[model samples]
Target chain A: MGSYNWNWPILLKEPYFGWIVSGFGKTILIAVFAWAIAFPLGSAIGIARTADNRALRLAGTVYVDIFRNIPLLVQMFLWYFVVPELLPADWGRWVKRDMPYPQFITAVACLGLYTASRVGEQVRSGIEAIPRGQRDAGLAMGLTPTQVYRYVLIPVAYRTIIPPLTSDFLGVFKNSSLALTIGVLELTSQARQIEEYTFAAFEAFTVATVLYCLVTGLVIVIMRIVESRTRIAGTIAVGAQ
Target chain B: MFGSFDFGILLANAPFLWNGMLLTLQLTALAVTGGLLLGVVLAVLRLSPIKPLAWVVEAYVNFLRSMPLILVIFWFYTLVPKLIGRPVSGFYSVLIAFVMFEAAYYSEIIRAGISSVRRGQISAAMALGLTKMQSMRYVILPQAVRNMVPVLLTQSIVMLQDTSLVYVVGLRDFLTSADIVASRDNRPTELYMFVAIVFLVICFSASRLANQLRRRYSL
Candidate 1:
């Protein structure tokens, strides 16, 4: 233990620094792209959960339950390894050999769908928290149920749920590290790579820890700004301490 | 793919998969128990009036919470041996990491639960001439535990699912066992599908139970 040397400089050197930067970029890329899928799909599922149609609600519940219950790592494996195999023989061959950035694509799809379930739950809660009077008022105004959601419920629910959504967004960043399992070579994977290449596990991980904190810190600040700016005047203040 | 699906290999590998599932369950149970115990202590320390001690505990929890659990596992997997001046088993390293990592999350939940107990309960206990420690034990914690149970169950479900991450360090957790058999048997779809179904059933039912408890207690 005493014989272990601390080598911080290697992280700043040529290839290692490049690895860190590229890994950082890939992580952000995966998280943001995944969010693109999650937000819309989750919002739809959330809306369905709150709707009057029994079948729609049941379907939404089924989707949320299945996606939320499975571990993200297993989901990642299934998407990467099993999905391609399940395709038609020629298509499977193409996915296995011809697809561009297969690992990255699988990572984004897996993470996107998984986080969608969580976002759906948050959206459901947000909508449920709205007063009964709000819905009744929309009905009295002769707005159809769909119109009521489109014009009234969704806008308010989305705003009210921003805080929880922000956390889920952060979850995506943290969860993006799992992409390393399927060889997407994101930030955590790169840190492990550096550790393997040089036995300076402490130094490599320390740098990774700092980088993760910086990204999360930046996200928190940005979300705080968004929260303040979009805060509706009379809505229930969540997390009001 | 469905027509060619191999059921026989899965039947042959059932014992192996079951053993892996057992290991996964064992890890989840140990981590949840250990994490909750450590978390309660952290929550108490953070809530205590000792400014320096509270500050230190807060920093530790926040730092751990900010990073990914996988990174924590890897760091401790590498760091513990150095600390002990000898190599340790992968299971021990992962156990240490899960307990510590989960403590941060569980502590926050416990802290919230404790805070949700009304301030008047403490005052009432004080008016009854009980000591602060006595008040906490007799008055506050019982109510806090009631509120905390449902959320704690939910968190444990999360940790149970997270136990699959043990595969990263090559420990043969449930998912890893399925993975091994899938690759060996060339039946990734069947094996992985079975793993997903197993996780879905356990976690979904657990969550439903959590929801029922929440409703029962809220009344």
Candidate 2:
């Protein structure tokens, strides 16, 4: 067997180090893009699930089911490769030409849709967790259904669902690495690239893993703070010490 | 335009897709079994009498839970073989990675189920001349396992979907095979629609199965 020289210090020099730093930036960018899109869409789908109209509820339910069940990678491929082809020729050409960031867009859409399903479920459960009398009281006061939901149901439900929503957000952040398969140069993808260049697999991935843990840990801390502040007084206690 | 939906292309690729489907099922089954075994061990560790052991298990679960499964998959694919001075097969690496990652998650679910078992039951078991292990094995485990049916099923379904990430390591799972066919045929839309439909069917069935289990067990 041939012995190969492995130099960790040299690997961290100049351009190599810059790439790792930029990779971190790209990861944060991907996570932010996905979360920003997913949160509101999830909230809407969640609200729709609780509507009076059965058809709307059904539509929302089906949407959530389809997205939640399929893998994000499959969905990203569909959005990037498949959906573009289905468009009209000029539009398809435009998408192929103008959309340099198809991978990023697809990542955001996939994460958003996937996270929305889980968030929708959380939202539904949160709303259900709130006592029915609150809605009834809102109705007695002559508030419209939208007003009741907007002013009463949603705020309370949002508060209750914050913890789960935080976890979902963290999941989105982690899952954004799937974008690499589609050519987005996020953290994992960049790490893979570095490993290919230098064959320093451990150093590359260990750094990536630590960065992921840092981001997710920050999310957990923020969620705990939110959970503490918004907790309904004496209603439910947090189980984790 | 790809000249409308082509049932012909789909029919032509059905056999290949079937092969891919079989592989997907194989990977999912293997990974789910591995996950369950690892999950059970970690669950026990998390509930161990020793505080340090519990803390270590908690950290493992937290780290695995936080890290993306794709990263874990990549880590196994790249680092494990390199670290061990051998090249591991992509399929086995993926399986191992899934097991390690999902175990942490499922362990938490199992731990939750175990903890949810009333304290009285354990005390009663102890009072009946049973050792701690015996009490856990007989009284706590049965109820915990029963209560965990729904969550365990859901986790399995999620794992099934997550198997698609194996494509990153160049594994020819369902999604990868479909990608190849799509790229080769230059009909990404039709091919992906087919892929999506396949995923939808599998996931929906799994979820339905989970619901059935939940109903049957009344967990």
Chain B TM-score, one value per candidate, order as shown: 0.96, 0.93
* Candidate 2 CAPRI grade: medium
Residue A80, candidate 2: C-alpha displacement in angstroms? 0.3
Candidate 1 error regions (>4 Å): A234-236
Best by lDDT: 1
Residues B1-219, model 2: lDDT tens digits: 545777788889888888888888999898889889999999988989899999999999999988888889988886566666888778887888988999998898899999989999998999999998899899998888888988898988889889888888878888888888888987778878888887889789889888887788754
What's the DockQ for every one of the candidates? 0.80, 0.69
Worst 10 residues of 2 chain B by lDDT: B77-86
lDDT per prediction? Answer: 0.91, 0.84
Give the DockQ (C-alpha) for candidate 1: 0.80
- Model 2 alpha-carbon miss at residue A101, Å: 2.7
Question: lDDT tens string, model 1, B105-144?
Answer: 9999999999999999899999999999899899998899
The best candidate in terms of DockQ: 1
TM-score of each: 0.96, 0.94
